[model samples]
Target: MAYQTTLGWSLISSGIVTLILKVLPYDSLWWGLLLLVLGIAILYLRIS
Candidate 1:
């Protein structure tokens, strides 16, 4: 339950971040790449 809740919130927050980035008139490709890198870093931290 705890893990699922945490995962759900992470996904929700990620989506919110994506939406905010979209609305801010920034470059999509760079924002997406940045998000991808951040996601990978988060996963690496969690895995270790």
Candidate 2:
């Protein structure tokens, strides 16, 4: 129910923000990996 609620887009936006952080000025692989994993985790939760 939480995901279906009005605030669901806010959750997705957070994930998008995470992805953007990884996108701009690539310097550390670890940072990009962290964002990638987090984005995947968010998508996983969204589907389940």
Q: List runs of model 1 lying over 4 Å from the truth.
A: 1-7
Q: For model 1, how does the per-residue alpha-carbon lDDT over 1-48 read when each residue is reduced to its tens digit?
A: 999999999899978987888786668888888888998999999999
Clashing pairs in 2: none
- Report lDDT (CA) for all predictions: 0.88, 0.77
lDDT tens digits by residue: candidate 2, 1-48: 875874888788768877877677766567778867987999899999
Using TM-score as the measure, the top candidate is 1
Model 2 worst lDDT run, 10 consecutive residues: 21-30
lDDT of 1: 0.88
Q: What is the lDDT of residue 12 in candidate 1?
A: 97
**CA lDDT of 18 in candidate 2?**
72
